[model samples]
Structures are given as structure tokens and as C-alpha cells.
Target: MGGTWMQVLGLNWLVLSVTGSAATMGVVVMLQSLPVLLLGSWGGALADRLPAKPMLIAFQVLRALLAVVLLAGDSTWLIYAVALLSGVVGSFEGPVLGRFGSALVPKESLGSALALGSVLSSAGRIGGMALGGILVGITGPSALFAINAVSYLAVIGALSLMRTAEMRYLPTAAPADRGVAAGLRYVRSQPVVLIVLALSFVLGSLGRNYQVSMAAMVSGPLPAAPRRTASSPRSSP
Candidate 1:
């Protein structure tokens, strides 16, 4: 979670730095989410077929590698490419985490477990954002990327150390439930699930891009305040 937030902050800062155009930043942000729109259902189906532990580990490693790729160049195109790859990995990561998290506890404690997870996630995000801004200011955005790379190591270590024996694995989905179409069919059969999915899609796409919007605002109008602060000295003359 911390690493993901750092990547968010670093990626947005890098985009604005490279292009100096809010429009381009928006496009870059959209490109990062494009994979979720295109492959999220497929990814969820994959999580049902595969063991979540290994898949989650693999995706985290892939994400850390992608963070390393960011250090290879400063080109906007390179950033966009890495962003797209990160998004693809993220789509799979989400489902794996969700399925794995649910399996980690008893049915009676599931609600408490989920609530705790949300609290920790929110805390991680807040910490990562604050740390990211500080790191960027102190050592530039690359430092945040490097720190994010290291953060994944901690997650990988924790996951490796977890007791697999205690987990309550759901029975593997039947052959018919092993594809994107199967997931769609199941969702369609459950009206509540279908409605929740639709609402999430709508809200997620529209509301979750605050990093992009804020980045654009900061890069554009927000900096003007600092300039005005500087010009106050001139005005005093």
C-alpha cells in the first residue's frame, strides 16, 4: 500500500515534470487506468483459478521491477509505457489480494478483518503520500520511486512468512467458472452484485483520478502563489 501510494505520487510528479502540460498528465493518468477497464474481469477470473499467494508475490515483484524501469529514463514516453505496465499488474494484484484477504480469517471475523484492512490501507496511503512529498522535496521524485521499490520487499517478506496452512481456501471454481464470461454471468445473475459492480465502475473511473487532477492543478495554478510570494520582494522596492 505504501509503495503503491509512493508510485502514485512519483508518477504524477514525473509526468508533470516531463511534459509540463496538464493535458498530457491527464492522458498519462488515463493510460495507467486503461488496463483495469480492459482486463479487470479477466484478472478476477484468473485469481479464482490460480493460487493467490504466488500470484500476489509475482505481481509485487513485477511492480517493483517496473519501478526500477522508471529510473532508466526521463522521457515522457518511457513513463507512459511503465505506467501502462504497472496498471496491468495492478488489475491482477487487486483481485488476488481481495481473494487472499477473505481467505485469511474465519467467516465470523471476516467483517472485522476487512475493516482492519481498510484502516491499515488508509493509514498506509496517508503515510506514503506524506513521505513521498517529503522525499521528493528532499531528494527528488526518483528517491520516492526507489523507496517504493524497497517497500515491496517488505510486503514480499511478510507474504512469504504467512502460515499457508491456516488459510481457508475456497474450492476451486468449476470449469465453467474459469473465464471472463463466467464472471460476467455470475454478476448478472446477482442483481445486487451487478449494481455494486456498475456503481464501482462509474465512481472509480470518475472519482479516483484525484491524483491526476491535483497534480495538474498544482503544476498549473498552484505554483503561481509561490511566484507571487517571490514578487512581493520586488513590489516592496
Candidate 2:
């Protein structure tokens, strides 16, 4: 969550600096989210079948590599490509992490675990944004990208140290019960779950794209003349 928030802050600043156009930044943000919006259900289905830990490790590695790519390139097209890839990996990673979290506690303690998870996620977001904003203002977005890449290593390392035997593993669904369609059917059978998911989808799609708004505000109202170079300085504008 920290790495994700850092990337969000750094990416928004970087996009504004590079294009100096809020419209282009909006398009980039959309490209980043498009994959997740389209394939999130498929990703959840995959989570139902795959082992979450290995899948999470793989996704984290991919995200770290994508960050490295962003750090290494200056092309707008390449940035868009990295964003797309990150979204693809993130779509799966989100659900896998949720399921993994559920498995970390007994059924009776699940509510507490989820509540704690929410608190931690909120804290991580706040810390990441604060630190990322400061770091980007000082060192630049590339440095934040590098730091985020290293953060992934910390997560991978921690996951590596976890004992699988101690985890409360959820049983894999039968073959007939697996896949996107099956998941949809299950959701449809549960009215409360279906309603919640529908509301979440609406909220996430329409109301939750803070990066787009942030980029527009920075580029529009908070304009600061950046260094006249292909690589723009990562400072507030």
C-alpha cells in the first residue's frame, strides 16, 4: 500500500511535469486504470484458483520492474506502457492480497483482522503520500520510483519469511466452481454481496480517481515553470 501510494503521488507529479497538459495526464491516468476496470473480475477468478503468496510475489516483482522501467525512460509512450502493465498486474494483486489477508486469521477473528487491515492501509496511504510528496519535491520522481522499487523488495522478503503451514489456507474451489462465470453466479446468489459490489464499482469508477484531479490542479492552478528539458524536475508546479 505504501509503494502504491508513493507511485501514485510520484506518477501524478511526473505526468504533469512531462506533458504540462492536464488532458494528457488524464488520458495517462485512464490508461493506467483501464485494465483494472475491465479485467478485475477475471483477476478475482484467478485469485480463486492460484496460490495467493506466489501470485503476490510475482505481481510485486512485475510492479517493481515496471517502476524501474519508468525510472529508465523519458518517453511518454513508454510511461503509458508501464502504467498499463502496472494496472494489469495490480488488478490481480489487489484481490490476491485481500484473500491472503482473510487467510491470515481464524473465522471468528476475521472481522478484527479486516478492521486492522483497513487501518493499516489508511495509515500507509497517508505516510506514503506525505513522504512521496516531500521526496519528489526534494530529489525528484525517479528517486521515488527507485524507492518504491526497493519497497517491493521489502514486501517480497517479508512474504518469503512467512511460514505457509501457519496460514489458514482457504480450500480451492472445485474445477466446476472456478472461473469468472462461477464467481459472478456466486455473487448474484448473494444479494448483499452483489449490491455492495455494484456500489463499490460505481464509486471506484466515478469518484475515486484522485490522481487525475491532482494532476489537473497542479498543472492548472499551481503552475511552476519547470526546467526547460525533456526530463522535467519533480517539484510542485
RMSD of each: 6.0, 3.2
Report the backbone clash tally of model 2. 1
lDDT of 1 by residue, 115-184 (tens): 9999999998999899887787667678888888988899899999998888986777788877899887
> What clash pairs does model 1 have?
none
Number of clashing residue pairs, candidate 1: 0
Clashes of each: 0, 1
Please provide, for model 2 over 86-113, each residue's C-alpha lDDT reduced to its tens digit, 9 standing for 90 to 100: 7788788888998998888999999998
The runs of at least 3 residues in candidate 1 whose Cα sits more than 4 Å from the true structure, single-residue gaps closed, are: 224-237
Clash list (residue pairs), candidate 2: 222-237
Global lDDT scores for all candidate models? 0.79, 0.81
For model 2 the local lDDT of residue 31 reads: 81
Q: How much lDDT does candidate 1 score? A: 0.79
Off by over 4 Å in 2: 224-237
